[model samples]
Target: MKTRILSLILLTVFASAAPAQKNEQNRPPIIDAHVHAFEKDERWTHKVANPLTGQPMTATTEQSHMQATLAEMKKYNVVKAVISNDYQAVLRWKAASPDHIIASYGFYDPSSQDLAFLRREHAAGRLMALGEIGAQYEGIAPNDPKMEPYFALAEELDIPVGIHIGLSKPGIAYDDAPKYRAALSNPLLLEEVLIRHPKIRIYVMHAGWPMLDQMVGLMWAHPQVYVDTGVIDWAVPRKEFHVYLRRLVEAGFGERIMFGSDQMVWPETIGMAVEGIESAAFLTEQQKRDILYNNAVRFFRLDKK
Candidate 1:
């Protein structure tokens, strides 16, 4: 009986240890360069279907959403994330998980007062980056004169600026943002901004999907520019996403691409986004690591952290 019991105990120990070891091998540390936080509101209480899988994603309250996001981060071994949202929401999420969160300022249109507030936040060490700057939704191009001040601020502060430069929700112009224009999605529109603010650190969010030629040209012209595979990583068809990603890599911009879930209300997309990169058979393990973590560390200056 003692021999049998000891054998069973050994089996149990090995069974428990096997999965942990496998998980460690399968899930490498990640640094999500794009994420969002939202205030608890009725807006998130409805199920939204995933565009790629067509599966309904459960809704959550503000508290539950934060909890779920953090849980997802832990599960995937996401060491860090750059989170953008309204000021209060960003603060709450940062407070809840100080070590995991990098606070970013999210804005649509900004006034001088908003710039002042951002300046103060940065001065106080509360804000690290500025973006998800959805100026495109307002029909504003990256080089629009109205956006000069914001870019100037970021350049002056030496913080990275993330701008929305590509596809939004389907029919966004018809229903959600009437000002949104497909022409504005062209990454080339940012050329002037890069020219004027040569020193500004900028990342084109969504990797300027569906605009492959322009995105590659812009990156070739401006080596300082980086991009994040945000919503396109999970929301688009897997094959399509891979084609776009592969082209960028083949064009020799692999080192500049970073991973971003563009995760809004659905926490599951975090895993989906990570899998999107991991599933790319064309990317070697080292290239995958660059996109998933190393690039962001260099882009965000996380080594200082």
Candidate 2:
């Protein structure tokens, strides 16, 4: 009897909250600015063996991952998602859902991607952006010479770019990626990249978490630089994430903030990320709208299309 009573109360709260959250759907279109559509079975091998340790990572099947991600996308009224994965999978996802998926180039290194292939795809409109460029996970700084050419190419093609920066999981260095360094997580290092590639439309993925001051300082110094709240939105403590987000918005970087789920193997994380922004009491309704959709629309030039 007590269990039944509790279930009723819980259902009531969920039912009541459903309508309130629908207001989010009533707003502008949502764009998930970060995603990786790697086939689940091959996800672990996508990055290849860890050089230092010659070890492998775990996996997620492609079909299952896609089905779940798409369902969640629908559930939340996401009109578009910027997806990054291995070349074949990325192409297939875009080809399969061209209208809903914005194909992006991603990997730990630019060298892993063929420049000619990327150029051809970008020319043909199959690849819309270059990103989740992630060499930062390998202890690389964005300003390194290795990344400048791609930055130039992105500017030349007028394609937006996204790069990983700051606050990866603790002890990530001991995992599959031995090069991971928490010290390299600073967004200030991106200043040189921004200065050199003034025309490139780039967003710092993960919003450079735990580097709030550096993130804010970088955005302040380089107004064109944008950010996406990805893994941190769902992985971090709700209150902690809110505090970081609130600080960014309070510091006057709201317009540049966008949504990204970084939904790898777990598609359920998409809703969690959305809720992170939506449930923030510190954020107003309009602010939520901006973070969920409007800012991304502007950042990705969706309005023009």
Candidate 3:
């Protein structure tokens, strides 16, 4: 009698769970444009007190971290992620998981060696684009001569540049003196650099928050300009995401928009970004498909493979 009761209870629970599980299984697939992975020792925290104040890196150990990243991608139906990381650190991410994570080489250290490495990796087609670069932190401006070589390499390679130009947290430093605040996060600073490097494609990360209108205006003005929705949720509300998407669509640049989860805090963050895009009122079924995958496929030239 006890065994029969236990079996019946198990059957009842599974019967109720089946449809919900099926619904999840049947949900549309997603392609996360932006995702992050790194070994625990690769963390940039030691360079600075907080990650916001410093460059972003992972804190998990190599063996388990790589497995977790792959598992999350498989479980969430994430087709691919355009990955960029510092030198030395996060090398295992690409070595261990190449299919899911497309790696790019860039180092925060502003030296010729960094640019040289970027040029070499770019020439080998190891990097799809030139960045997660630009002057998010202080003491670096978009037009700094130090960055010209990398820009030139990007032009020669004919790949887009992924730039992070937007408001960071209150405590994050832009330089020795100023913290990365709303005022300094303007996308207009990129104007001079874009003018100088017209041939180079630029994907402005974070969509230039606090100056979002200006960012949209910049994208409208520049034909090669694009934006990715990475780590923007913390700044923009869910409704605002729809509003922004609709605005971009109305501006005739919907096709250029890419979805990025900015998966540093957690693996589930990727799923959250996909859910946000799906839940947005501005996106129709077709638009959702484009934002989730098709756009990235075309932008990254993934279809060629």
Candidate 4:
């Protein structure tokens, strides 16, 4: 009887000491629709704090950043990523991880020479998409005439485009981007552009956060438009992010929403971003799968590849 009691106590202790297991191993494969790559630069040496959490991310060298990002992707079963950066930096990442990387050209304002370069690169199959086109940082609206040619080019190529349309870093307008305006983040600004270029496959980056009504209206009006939950997936408070996402899903737009990390400097944010969607109780198993992988597959036409 004493021996049986001791065994029972040992069993309880062992069970209590064991680490809780997550079903992540059984989780469906993911495709992060937004990611960024960069060359070795002094800027990477500085730790940046997460605006919502006040937690400073670890500083990383270019090599470490690439290694950690890839490791995180593997850990989370991320099968593919749409990566944007300077031409050469993106090329390097693609060369290193050809199977996982979808190369995109990220630009603010493209010079005539830059446009020519993009044309040549796309023809040569070096670039697949155009954007994080961040003209908003320059206070340029999506309907600005200056953006027309870029949209035209995207339409002509039949490749996807991801545009920055929503909130930037807190206080970014005060310093980093003096021209930045919150008003330009409105999804409604894209209406004219969308109407003019009906064939362009474009997705709003950050899902046009905090502009729920405008975003919903835009998507309802323009069925071709899609969105990526980039920085907001992990950068915003979880409760707020979930509420916004739930609204989009409930509004019958779940099929167009895709997962993105917008993982600029912090590699671990990739996993955090995935967890953000996984933690949403309102989403069904199929809805979560669609957001994580299927939606992007359909949007990007990956099945054709």
Candidate 5:
């Protein structure tokens, strides 16, 4: 009689807890994989001075932009955002929102100076990943010896590398200005580095831009390769961008695709993209979960806690 009663009690408790557990499991957490933030600075601007064009960037305040971002995240229930920025701003966001921000370092190019700093930061646990690094339209290469140290350290530490491919700012000098072209945007160029250091988690940002289809192929070929949908959605026409992303999902690359607003433009833009992904007909509920949270959680090892 005592054993029967104990068993009955446990069953009763589990039966009552089932719905709550299901509800918890059903609620998907939102994560913005591509994000940029800045500190309180007087001279910050989202507009980049086209080095190639020699045009100046119109300065804008980051205060309103950041506030709007936080509000949007709250609206969409975004649990966290993987944030990157120039050295100063990254540190500021980390300090301000340590709980919600996963900080990363940026490499302008394959410069020894930048590589040394990132390598040291990576070893010290100051940055979670290495990225927005790669050959720009200007025809720079990342595997140069200067970038080798950073790559090696990242490989050793087991952090993902994010590369800003496809689209980039023009050159400062007109003669040497980087041109946007298919040759410069090829994902195959990364094959050498990927084959050389297979352990490194490399993410092709902007879904490799106008080369999304090509990038999908690259991700298929390389188990360790991944891509983040950054400003592409907002930057491109909605109808066409939707079709492009749909093809990515149809190709079964949804899990490998990460969600990011490329928040350089604005914080609200981040919320809109998250909503777009959530409502996407191509992605099932569980698939949405993977894209928004699980993928990042696994890619970045956020659950190490």
Candidate 6:
């Protein structure tokens, strides 16, 4: 009779909790940790490879792309996106919808960026992040001397950084960033920097894919480091992505992984990135919720907003 009574109580508790759980699961807002916005007249456009054709994907006009991005954000329930773009361009886009965009300083050359300007923007609440600091494209590592100032600044200010790590698309060497180095993709190389700036909120942009062991080692050693599923979430071959992601999840780092569209010129890919995380067969419902929304919220402190 005691056992029967206990079971009834347990069922009653679960029944009462079910609705709240379901409501929370349905549509929690997302924080897309990595994305870039391009102006139409700007020479640079966000590029994505066609998974099917192995060819370049074209984007509509810059105006159309921005419109599509915001629309998709609404459709996907993404409340905020961390945008990496030129300083003025970031200002223009964020000014249009200040609440929705988290301004990030996108640096091509770490040595060339104006630290003073960066600090000012960050101080003004116009910039909250410091990357897509793509040194790998220049055959540079995250720990390169040129990167020290930028990393140090982020650490000093307690701003989150989303750095590029891991492989670039195949044949990227043929593109403008010919100096791309595959070896620099290793997440372990960031150790020195991590050690130097222990308190800085940092997340590897690609989650150091194809370097899973290294990334796992990095994560195991440094609890402060986090990651985002950018291109791999949408662009990589599904099986390859899943194998790496499954191992990461199983190894007890699921809480640290966040979602990023890496949506450069491709606005439509935003939904694809969301679908990639949502469609993962290995992740449970709760795990999906964490990856989709909760984890990023914690990483960026978006809940405080």
CA lDDT, every prediction?
0.83, 0.76, 0.61, 0.82, 0.64, 0.77
Candidate 3's displacement at residue 189, Å, is 2.1
Candidate number with the higher TM-score (2 or 3): 2
**Whose TM-score is higher: candidate 2's or candidate 6's?**
6
TM-score leaderboard ranking: 1, 4, 6, 2, 3, 5
Which 10 consecutive residues of model 4 have the lowest summed lDDT? 1-10
Better of 3 and 6 by TM-score: 6
- Which is the better candidate, 3 or 5, if ranked by TM-score? 3
Model 1 C-alpha lDDT per residue in residues 195-239, reported as the tens digit of each score? 999999999999998899999999999999999999888888899
**Residue range with the least summed lDDT across 10 consecutive positions in model 6:** 1-10
Candidates 1 and 5: which is better by TM-score?
Answer: 1
Tens digit of lDDT per residue, candidate 4, span 117-197? Answer: 889999999889988888888888999988888899999999999999888877777766788888999999999999899
| 292 Cα displacement, candidate 4 (Å) | 0.3
TM-score of each: 0.89, 0.84, 0.78, 0.88, 0.76, 0.85
lDDT of 3 by residue, 128-212 (tens): 6656663446446666677778777777788877777665544445333352334546777777778888888777777665576
Off by over 4 Å in 2: 1-28, 40-60
User: What's the distance in Å from true for residue 168, model 3?
Assistant: 1.7
Q: Which stretches of candidate 5 lie over 4 Å from their true place?
A: 1-27, 39-59, 62-64, 142-146, 168-182
Off by over 4 Å in 6: 1-26, 41-59
Candidate 3: 10-residue stretch with minimal lDDT: 1-10
Compare the candidates by TM-score and give the number of the best one: 1
The C-alpha RMSD in Å for every predicted model, in order, reads 10.7, 9.2, 10.5, 10.9, 15.6, 13.7
Candidate 3 Cα deviation (angstroms), residue 294: 1.5
Displacement of the residue 216 alpha carbon in candidate 6, Å: 0.3
Candidate 1 regions with alpha-carbon error over 4 angstroms: 1-26, 54-56, 111-113
Error of 1 at 170 (Å): 0.9
Give the per-residue lDDT of model 6 (tens digit) for 104-169.
888766767788988888777778888888888888888888888888889999999989998676
